[model samples]
Structures are given as C-alpha cells and as structure tokens.
Target: MSIWRSYPRSLKVLLLAMLVNSTGMAFLWPLHTIYITQGMGKTLSEAGFVMMLHSAAEIIGSFLGGYLYDRIRGKRTLLLAVLSSACFIFIISIGLSWPVYILMMILLGLGIGTIFPPIYALAGSIWKEGGRKSFNLIYLVLNFGVAIGTALGGIVAQFSFQYVFWVNGFTYLLFIFIVWRALDEPDPVYEAAQKKALDPRPKKEFRPLQSFYSLLILCLGFMFCWVTYIQWQTSISTYIHLLGFPLSSYSALWTINGLLILLGQPLLQWFMDRVKSPVKWQLLSGVIFFILTFALLSQNQSYGGFVTGMVIMTIGEILIFPAVPAIADRLAPLDRRGMYQGLVSGAANVGRTIGPLLGGLLFDGFGPLVLLYSCIFICGFALICFGTYQRLQYIQKEVSTVKVNK
Candidate 1:
C-alpha cells in the first residue's frame, strides 16, 4: 500500500491502463487457436498460420508505435492506437466469416501492439527513479488482469464466445476513456525528460550504440524464449484438448499461471535483490527452467503432469519477461527509450509469429514428443545467446574504460 501510494500519478494511471488492456486481451487470446481449430473447423496448421499473420502485423504496429511516441509524443499516438483497436475489436464482436475474421484479428493485433511501447516508455519517463520496480509492478498488474480475465473468459466462453468478444471490446473502450481522462494532463516530468533527451551530448560512460547491440542480442534470446513459451498457447492448447481435457481446464492453466506469478512476486524480488548481476542471472537461469519445462512435457501426458509443467514454465516467465524491459530501459538513451522498448516488443512478436506455425507443423508432422524436444533444443540456444550477451556487455565496458584512461 505504501509502495502503491509512492508511485507518480501518471505511472498509477499507466499501471491501471496496462491492467485493463491485458485483461481484455486475455479474454480472447487464450481462446483464439481453440476457436479457429474447433469453432471454424480449421486445422491446427491453419490456425497457426493465422496467428503468425496476426503477430507479424503486431511487429509492424510495435515499430510504428515507438516511432510515433518518439515523434508525436504518447498522448495522441496512444489515442489513435486505442481508437483503431476498439473499432476492430467491436467489428470482431459483431461476428464474421473465416477470411474476414482473420483480417480483423490481424488489424486488432496492430492496434494492441501500438499501445504497449508508449505505456512502457511512459512508465520509465514518469518515474525515472523507479527502475526495475516500475517494470515489475507493471508486469504484476498485467498478470493480475490475466488471472481475472482468463478465469472469467473461460466461464463466459462456456456460454457463448460472442460474449467473450464483446467483453474484450468493452475493455478497450474503457482503456480509451481512461487515457482520455487521465493521460491528457500536461506532464512536467515527462516534458523535462523529453527536453533532456533532445540534448546532443552523449554520456561518455554509457555507449548507446554498443548498448543497443547488446539489446539486440538480448532480444534474440527473448525471441527464442517466446518461441518456446508460445507453444503453450498454440500447439499445447490443442494437444491438451486431444488428450480429452475440457476447454475450461485448458483456460484454468493460464489462470494458474497468472495467479502463481502474482503470488510469487515477493519471492522473486527477494531473489533479485540478493543476486549478483540480477538481470543476467535471471535470463540465464530462466532459460534453464524453460528447457526443463519442455523436457518434462516430452515425458508426461496426464493432467497433473501438465499442471506441473505449467508451474515450472511460470517460474521461467516470472524471471525473464519483466527483466527484459528493465534491461532495455537501462540501456536506452533517453531519446531512444521508445525505440528500444519497441525493438524488445517487436522481437517477442517475431517469436510469437514463428512459434505457432513452427509448433503446429512440428506437431502435425512429427508428434508432441518431437514438438516438445524441439522446444527444449531451441531453449538451449536461448541460454547461449543470453550468456554471450553478458560477455559482450562486459567487453564493451572494458573498451569504454580503455578510452577513458587514454
């Protein structure tokens, strides 16, 4: 409570907006592959292809949002993104045939993608001192929304998926209203940060270009992480259904994921606080867990096995997801914060774009064992990438020191 009260007004609103946004998204996203596969009688491969397209669109949107935030500022850019998303989502709620449904989903991805960079950028801008705490708080709230939304979405979907679509659309409308009312105010803090960012001088101690190289490397690992992670939503969801688990049971997995994340925050914070080079350790250790997740999945087929795998996966998610943005925040030049954040988001989307298609094809062609083993192999590469990333950062610092001594 004390910590919550300590946040700046804009950050508080940003957190609220993120919560609302993610909750709405959760209502539909967990069900997307399910709907396409069963409701429309599409094959898993077809559903994967559609999801890939949607994620590709989101990549474009992430870039556009970052550029817009850096250029026009967040207020107007956010309004445009939210308004467009709401329109697309409303149309989706109204019902459509296959091809049309596909197109609307892609467009909705664009809108949703644009919303994130600005929110993340603004969180850093508003509370410059908050550092990892700010990103973690945002992440915490996001999962809370997921927890609430997924649980409710499962129930609502039991009755009718039409209502699920409507609920998602309504939340976007609510987000628009919040932005209009709360975010329109003149923010002196953000304005001051913007002005500082415009300064031509570089911080000699910090190398923006080199740091960005590191960020790109980190993002590659992030991309791989998402590739493995997204299987739960894509192939794994369908696989569970084939195993005879109910849709509500599948959705409950996500609910458990979200709830566990919420419950585990304090422990994560403690671990982080005590760790040396926390973010690096977080990435490395998380990838290890990701590998373990798939390894377990390859062997087990029961409900208990799935739950245990999810629990392991959730721990990796807790370690990895929030830390990536926090690292990006640290590395970004004040002027390029939005751009850096965008790249991070875009990288994740790239993984998402690939994951579904790859997982589906692997599952269809080979089987679940092959799919799970493939994920484990990819996660090994992720571990290597993050490890190499830390090494590069260390080398960059040494080079900078040499230049300073000269």
Candidate 2:
C-alpha cells in the first residue's frame, strides 16, 4: 500500500492497468495452441501457424504503436489500443468457432501488441531516475496478474472454457475504463523530446546511425532469446497435453512460472544492484539458463522435471526481460526513444512468431528432441550477438568521449 503510493501517480495507475491486462491475457495464452489443436480439430502444425499469425500482427502493432507514441504523445494512443483489444475480445466471446476465432486472435494480437511499447515508453517517461525499477515493478505486477489468473483459470476450465472467455472480456473492459480515466496525463519527458526535435543543430552532432546499429544487434539477439523462451507456451504446452495431462495441470505450470517470478524479481534485483554492469551479467547468465532449460526439455519425462526447468527459466527471465527495454533506453537518442523501444518489442514479437512455427515443424518432422536442440543452438548464437553488441557500445562511448574532450 505505502509502496504503491511511493511511485509516481501515473506509474501507479499504469501498474493497475497492467495487472488487469495481464490477467485477461493469461487466461488465453496457455490455451491458444491447445484450443486450436484439440478443441478446434486442427493439427498441431495448423495451431502453430495460427499462433504465428498472432505474433506477426503483433510485430506490426508494436512498430506502429511506437510511431504513434512519438506522434500523438498522450494517452489517446493507449486508449485506441485497449479499445481495439476489447472489441476483438468481445467478438471472440460471441463465438469460439474455427476461422472466426483465428481472425479474432490475429486482430486481438494487433490490438494487444499496440499496447506494450506505449506502456513501456510511459513507464520510462514517468520514472526517469529509477527507470529500471519502474519497468521491473510493472513486470512484477504483470506476473501477479498471471499467477492469480492462471491459478483461477485452471480451476475454472474444469467446467467450461466459455466462462474463461466471458471473464477475460470483463477484465479487458475494466482495463479500458482505467486507461481512459486515469492515464490521460501527458508525459513531460516525451513532450520535451518532441519540442527539442524542432531544432536539429544539437541532435545532428550525435551519430544516429551508430545508435541504430547498436540497437539492431541488441534486438536481433533478444529476438532469438524470445524464440527460445516461447517454446514453453507453444511446443512445451502442447507436449504436456499430449502426455495425457488435463488443461488444469498444463495451466498449473504457468501458475508456477508466474509465482516463481514473483519470488525471484526482488531477490534478483538486490543482486543486480550490487553488480557493476548488470546488463552484461543479465545476458551472460540468461543464455546459460536458456541452454540448461532446453537441455532439460530434451530429456524431461515428468511434471517435476518441467517444474525445475521452469524455475531456472524464470530466473533467466528476471535477468533478461525487464532489462531489455531499459538497455534500449540507454542506447537510444532522445528523438528516437520511442522507435528503439518499439523495435525491441517488435523483435520480440517476431521471435514469438517464428518460434512456434519452427518448433511445430521440428516436432512434427523430427521430434521434441530436435526442437529442444535447435533452441539451444539459437541461444548460443544469441549470446555471441549480445556480447558483440556490448563491445560495440563500449567503442561508441569511447569515440563520443574523445569527441567531447576535443
């Protein structure tokens, strides 16, 4: 309670909205592919393709949302996104049939995708000094929503999946209302940056292309990270179901995953604060966790093994996800902040789009072992890319310092 009020007023409001949005979203994500495969009478490959489409829409939405963040510079952009999400979700509640549901999923993806970057940008806007803390808090509460929603969703699903639809829709309605009323405040930093853009003299000296290159490498690595990460939702979830576990059991793993994140964030934050270069440690430690988790999956036969892998993966997630946007914030020039954040987000979605499609094909053509091995390989590649990006950043900084001294 005291901690809630300690944040900027806008940050507090946004966290609540994040909570609602995540809760609603959690109800669907764990079920998406399974619903298409088992309930809709679609094949696993078809389900993967549908999930890919959802992520593809998200990639478009993310970049567009970033552009709007720079252009519109207020809560209206957010309102538009939430409104679109709610509308699509409402249509989904009316009918859970085949092609209609797929269309709704893709539209909902666009709407949902549109919401993230602006929210992230707004977090950076409201909490300037403690920017990392703001992103972590938002992420922490987002998982609270996931933990609560998945726990309840697992139980509710025992009776009717339709009820899940209605409840998720209701949460979105609540999110829309909250964003409309409480989140209308202008972001001071964003406004200042927009005004500064009018005079090109100062910004012209800064190497925008160098900044872009750094972001491109960082996002490319991060995208592979997501590609490997999301197999839990797509391939792994379907794999669990095929083993004859009920949806409740499959969903419980998510409940556990969310709960573990809740426990992990604070402890990890304490440790991160002690490190000199937290971002470097984040990527280094994250790829190790990635390697280990995928290896576990290749041999995993029990729920308990999945549980252990999920906990390790959650630790890696805490190290990585909240920091990615913050790193982009550090890399971006004032004028390009929104676009950099958007591109990072877009890269993540692109990874999500490709992950399940590739995983499904691998699982169908070869086996789960093949998919797991491929993810491990990609994680190795991500590590090399991230390390190179960091070295490049160091060079960029040295060049800038020498220029300033002259």
Candidate 3:
C-alpha cells in the first residue's frame, strides 16, 4: 500500500498537533531537572523525589485518560488535558516555589496524562483502514517529535529556563487550537463496533486476567530498559562533567541522542516489518544495549566512548520502542485498546520514576561505573523474562492449532 494512503485529513491534523506539542515539550525536557537542582538550589535527592511524584501523577493520569477515552468523547478529554497543562505551565513559570512546583508537577502530570489514550484511540480508530501501516506511521511521527524536542530543548536550555516554559506554554496553546480546528470525533458506529468486538461474552471470551499477567511480565523488562534511558538523560551529564568535560557537553549529548533517534526510527521500522518475528528483534536490541552500556562504563573519561555508547543505545531503542505498542496491539482485546495502551504507558512511567532516583543514589555513592553495572544487570534480567514469554507464546500457538484441527 502507498504510504500516503494513511494521510487522511484528520490523521494529518492530529500528527501536526503532536509535532507542535512535542516541540513545546522539547523545550522543557533538558531543563526541568537542571532548573530544579541548579537554578533553584534543590538537592539531587529533592529533584529526584519531585520527578518521582510527577511520575506517580502521570500513572494516575494515564489510566484515567484511558478510561475516559472509552466512555467519553476523545476530543473533549484531549482539550481538558491541554487546558490543564497550560494552567500548570503558567504556575511553573510564575511561582517557582517548592510547594507550588510540587503542585504543578501533579497537575501537569494529569494534563499530560490526558493526551496519550485519546491520541492512540484517535489513531487506531481513524486509520482502521491502514492497519499495521497506520500504527507504524504514528510511532514514526511520535518519535520524530521526541527527537526534535530533546534536540531543541538542549539548545534552548542554554539560553534561559524561562524561555523553555514560555515556548512550552505557547506550543500547548497552539496545539489546542490546531486540534480543535482539524480533528473530528470517531463515528458512533465505529465506537459501537469496537465495544462489541471487546465484549467478553463472545465465543472466545476476552481474557483480561491472562492478558494482564502477560503484560506484567513484559513490563518487568520495560521497567529496566526505561530506567536505563532515564538515567542517561539525568545523571550522564554530571558523570561527564566529573570526568573533566565542559558543562556544555551535556546539551550536546541530548542533541546527539535525539538526532540519532530522529534518523533511526523509520529505518528500523522498515527493517522490522520485513523480519519474520518481532520478538527476535526485541531480544537482539536488548542484548546490544546491554553490551554498549557495559562498554561505556569501561571508558568513562573518553569522549569517543560516550558517543559510541550513545549510538549503540539509540539503535537498540529504535528496535525496542515501537515494538512495544505493536505487542500491545496483539495482546489487547479489540475493544479495550485504550486500556492496553494505558497499561503499557504506566509500566514505562513506573520505570521512569525509579530510574532517576536509583541512578542518582548510585552515582553519588559508588560512582558512574556502579550505575552502569546496575543497568546491565537489570537489562539482563529483562532479556531472561522476554525469553520465558516467547516460550510460553510458542506453546500457546501450538495448542491453538491442535484445537482448531480438532
């Protein structure tokens, strides 16, 4: 099928909004922790705690967003999230007090939470005709936003913290207007059909418990991977600084990771589609990431080593990240897509919450090498879990075939 076939007007509008929203978020990405710790004079532990709180709020918000999307209009829920986010941004820019910052984190988490489920639902519902291609396109564009946001956020942070908030607020405002103008709610027939498909009373009842257990196993691996990624963003700069690099290199690192992701995601997607089993690619990526991270610890002071590590990690990320939603699509009940997406997102959030705090503690105590070793161990455990999951899936498939023949 032609790639452009998925580019209907509504999908186009949603993608554009995502681009703008992401660009705005990029302004905040590199600065949020820096501003709290350095600019506002909080301790590393304090900053980590705040981030943990933010993640907790995000977990709540994501699940709530998913539930709302299933029951209410998608557009209304999105608008609420955007507006609420704008309010938090205003508070962050103005108050800058500790209590206010904590409150804003919770509110902002809720605001951001509103976006994921509705956006995924919109993509799945609208691009029903495009199938896997549609899902791939959405993943590609979302990562594109992430790459741009992280890259630009580093550049912008070099200027001023306030500039980041200003850009973030304005982008959100623009996102609200764009979404309002361009998108339409899903058709009622489409909604009803989705609900029917997910109904548990069908010949083959939807197995929520089984799916939940499967996701729990998958999430254990995801938690480890995400913790490693978050640590790279949060503590790697400090580690490099201690190794005698200039402070400015921090931004450069973020820029490098973002640029690689921007360039790599589409190519990886194309390659994975041609490969027979996504599980193989997922396992391969995890192994690559583990090795590169180990190598990075051995050459702590070498700029070349850092850059090589970043490249290797980015390749692994390209393979692993998009495969997550694809796996969710396969595992989820047809009608409960939003819930499945929420669970996946929530698992990542849990990882994000723990990663920074744990990394910070390790970096401060035993140093960077210890942190790297911890990451390698966690990832190794994740790979073992993935192996178990693969074996179980194989058995399940064989059993299904036998039943079908009977």
Per-residue lDDT over 194-296 for candidate 3, one digit per residue giving the tens place of the 0 to 100 score? 5456553543332554565676677677777788878776777778888888867766766677777767666766676677546655655656676576667
In model 3, which residue pairs have backbone atoms overlapping below 3 Å? none
Ranking by lDDT: 1, 2, 3
> What would the per-residue lDDT of candidate 1 be over residues 353-404, giving only the tens digit for each residue?
8887899889999999999999999998899888887666678778888998
> Per-model C-alpha lDDT, please?
0.85, 0.81, 0.73
- Quote each prediction's TM-score: 0.88, 0.86, 0.85
lDDT of 3: 0.73
Question: Could you tell me the TM-score of candidate 3?
Answer: 0.85
Number of the top-ranking candidate, with TM-score as the measure: 1
Q: Is candidate 2 or candidate 3 better by TM-score?
A: 2
Q: Which candidate number has the best lDDT?
A: 1
Candidates ranked by TM-score, best first?
1, 2, 3
